[model samples]
Target: MSELKILIVDDDPVTRSMLKHTLNAHGYLTAEASDGADALAKMAAETFPIVISDWNMPNMNGLELCEQIRKHDSEGYIYTILLTSNNAMEDRVKGLRAGADDFIGKPFNKDELLERMAAGERVLNLETREALIFALAKLAESRDTDTGLHLERVQRYARFLTQELVGDPAFADEIDEEFIQLVYQTSPLHDIGKVGIPDSVLLHPGKLSKDQFKLMQSHTVIGADCLKGAIAKSPKAKFLHMAHDIARFHHEKFDGSGYPDGLVGEKIPLAARIVAIADVYDALRSRRIYKPAFSHERSCEIICGDAGSHFDPRLVAAFERVHEQFATIAERFSEPSELPGSAEPKELEMVH
Candidate 1:
């Protein structure tokens, strides 16, 4: 899609015309509406990513318009800005409660309006980046038919374990709700380096030789190295930094024996450690060319037995606490070939 279109709504023709002209001069494609009702009618026929509405319009006011937009489904964020004369705290609270993103006081300068819109555009860009990241991860996973829903399952499992860790005294400082959600989004990219691997190796139906296995293991470093340049350029992008850590260290073991890096115990980044068990558990339960599907009981035993070896003991304990959630996710997002152990099999979609 090209740049998103904006909707301008106001009861006064003068105010609506001024906004339309000003935004168009700023290079924004805009559509004008006489009032909130007209704006909603236009929205029903077409999508508007941003809605700029006057606070007091007849038939349907801006507050009601904002609330209605919030209740409607949108493919992307529909940021609403209210043009209001009131600068009082109570009015601001009411506008926010009614779902407005920001309030632009009446008689506002062009610079102020443009600045607010620029901030809103930045948020929309971030959401676009996240969606593209997920799509790219899915593209990488799609190469191997056996890997159906692997990315979704691991991210969900990782999210569950990370969420549980947020309350533990050991991880309270490092794990929070935002961090858990980031793990859910970035975990899918852990194996994104597989995109660089050859079809012959990736689609093989048998075990790879030692050299091929070495080539396969390079996916970790390959993914990390690729993300390093991205992090250097963005510097402040926390998601890229976490992605780099996860892509590089997810294969590293708790004991100093696993591949790519011999990171042991607390030496491994916490996010990588959390995803390690998630990836392992999902691989064990899901059928693959190299291994038959292991029963849930056997899979759990392997994970529990490897505590302090294949995974962090604390995360293992976290896993023990949320294993049922993991099992539910596994059954819900099983391979396409496997019968969905749940009543509904779902494809994960972005929530804008």
Candidate 2:
């Protein structure tokens, strides 16, 4: 295993020195902080995935530190371990509620410490899994030459809409921080099934025939089935479950008019409903072989016009509120080649 840089926070110099020496001896890099406050300062300046802090301190205790860490806008997860002699069940509960991942007795055992670190490493390894998921999504996207940054833009739009819906009473029970993150991470896989589409149909330079369009629509099922297989192997992967839902249902219309399964209204998975709006909006704004890119205002009008027919009305309302932000994100990630007047139109490919 590669060495992990850990921050040791405690007011006791001896304990800090001992812990740092033990960690460094075991191929782990160590940094010392006098208290939780000091640790927070260091964290603000540097990235540390693991934090070992004592329960008792002058400025801030370990529990406080854990709470602060959880509240901080860090880009990645931080595994926090609290060191305390207090063995009371209530104290342990308090630490857990404060966001502590693990606890160690005041007189810590070296083997136990290392084992806990290993467990934390395993948790951090989820990051690697998420990266692999995106790579797989990218592989599917590679089949289409015209979808430059489509995945990136769609994920952002989905995340933005989901974030806005967090305040809505109708979705209050559904959307949360984890939901928002999952939408952002899994939205890119919405079209992964397109890989199964034959080039003759997927890359056709003209409008698809009735049979070809039917085959083209099968990409949703193909992608969903691929994720279903992965889910069968790892049933507990929440991201896969969401990705499966998005892949299968993102193309479903809100008014019972969509394909594969005519799931209408709230019956469609909420994640899929949210992604449908995002995907369509980006598709409208993006340049396609058959259609030129639409302006932000024009895109908004089309989306708003189809609020109840193509998208969930609640989500459409949320989109209306954040339409400006969506345009900003689109502009930020827009490919220069996709911009208007940058390139002449190519042979048309049928887009769903």
Candidate 3:
């Protein structure tokens, strides 16, 4: 692997010299900036994965520099490590609040600096991988679900479900903020492999034949393969790989009754299992060529009946709490075919 480019921003020449020598000896390439202005200029010229900057400088100090970096880009993350002579609690808090990835006390230990920089590198790599994964997810959604709104609605439903679960004491730690946000953003890709399924099956107006049902099931494998292929190209993308697991296993049931793989109970990945309930609920309540949409109440009844039989009981409980949000989502994204008098199902209310 090529050496990571490190940018040093310290007014003191001696400190820069020592850092450069220490980092070079450890096989990292170094760049120097006497002040924040120079550092920002250098940053614009070339992308440096890690920046070690002294907290106090003439103009555009390290804290300001970190804030500016945070504002400027969306594609790549720049890790800023602040060097501080000030040991005040407020000073450290300010630096972190301004976006410095780490703050090192003045007279920083060489080994500690190296360790912190390594940690910063890990964070930057993770950010880059996430960007790539999200891009691929967008591509997958665009290809399969023709309407641009499908992804939005699915993600919204996932977020609502996750938020409801996180609020409950039982799932607070398990569905932390990061996991909830990731699942909310990536859950829409569950149907990505529908792109690979023939339109004849995907757009059929009636129930699928046994043979066609078998073929339709291949979408899970196909979607997983697409993401696996993406990971083969970019091995650092861990979240994309997680999304692949969701796409492949979301259909698997809690009672060993679902498609592709019949994973049962906790055997299914938690994220995938959560997504399965959300996906089926949305699919049932949304209009599709094969069937008219079900009423929100009937959809809830169907899902409630399947607790522990087709879904995780805990998630089903969560779903029950947030079922109203699902109705809101249906109202927001109901297709034209699902509008009033459009092949009205017998049991559904004709909500005008």
Candidate 4:
């Protein structure tokens, strides 16, 4: 309803015109592209939430377009519906593998097309929410010297560790498909409170003095306060609530030594516990102004060393099982396939 635009991709001008007119008549905005190549070109100029593409086209085809979109686009997920004459199961399978969300057969029915579009709208709206969450976290990350890659790397690492925890006796109830997904989506904000820390403390190239260190520790509270405000406005948003927990408690240790509340053992939020492992591992591997990046082996030993004191012992076991995977994740930015489809982020872009 917010002036949603649909991109209509087809080689046939007649078909394109008809689809464009039909969408426009229903109070929707539309754009036209002659083929998959043209559609990609259009995307370079602007992003469309929904794309209705024909299966057969000159040069590149709809399937290729969907694959390309899944690979390159991260501003948000694009809901793609293939308009094809082929109704065979194999064709649908191919389209799905290429990342098409829904489909409409050729000689489209006005009613059926509308139904598919409605389904796509629902999916796109969900993606928009995820994008906004990432954008807000990026906003907070911008206040720090480290690139937003810090968030991207941590998100995957958290998700990787969390997925392996599923069904373990300790996390039998807490670790599910949904929990794993929300953690991946919301884990990046663990340091969102750093936005409130002054640069003298946050960006200090040297070791912090006792007072400076104390000031630095307050970032957990700062981030939580920001997310708590958002939660108040959207009381039913589970992700926002999870983000608040992560921002406030990720630094809390399994023992009582951690700050901002000194929650010990199971008292720390499970989301925070998971993110702490991820955040620490990333911090150790990433190069800081004061310290060079630690070797993967050294980072592993440190995390394993802190198992009972700083991290959940069960999660440390999980990390051991996935240590190689964690190292792989550090080298790139991608979430596990168990969550929604992921795209490689080019770099940290500030959320406007």
User: Under the 3 Å rule for N, CA and C atoms, how many clashes does model 4 have?
Assistant: 1
What's model 1's lDDT at 237?
A: 89
| Lowest lDDT 10-residue stretch of candidate 1 | 343-352
Q: Residue 99 error for model 1, in Å?
A: 22
Candidate 2: global Cα-lDDT?
0.84
Candidate 3 residue lDDT tens string, 66-172: 86775453236577899998778767656754666687888889999888878877766666545555566677566435343556566667766765564455654
Candidates in order have lDDT scores of 0.79, 0.84, 0.75, 0.79
Tens-place lDDT per residue, model 2, 94-170, is 67656677888989999989898998888777767667778998998898898898987888788768766755669
> Ranking by TM-score, best first?
2, 4, 1, 3
For model 4, the superposed segments whose C-alpha errors exceed 4 Å read: 1-124, 333-352
Alpha-carbon TM-score of each model against the true structure: 0.62, 0.67, 0.58, 0.63
In model 1, how large is the Cα lDDT of residue 163? 56
Which residue pairs of candidate 4 clash?
A: 193-223
Tens-place lDDT digits, model 1, residues 1-352:
2355899999888888888878888788899898888998999998888899999989999999986775443556677899999789768756764667787989868889998889778656666676877898898888888877888788778866775665466876786545765787799899989988998887767667677777888989989998999998999988999999999999888997886878788889999999899998887777676555666776788789888877888889888977887877778677566542321111110000
Q: Where does candidate 2 clash, by residue pair? A: 193-223
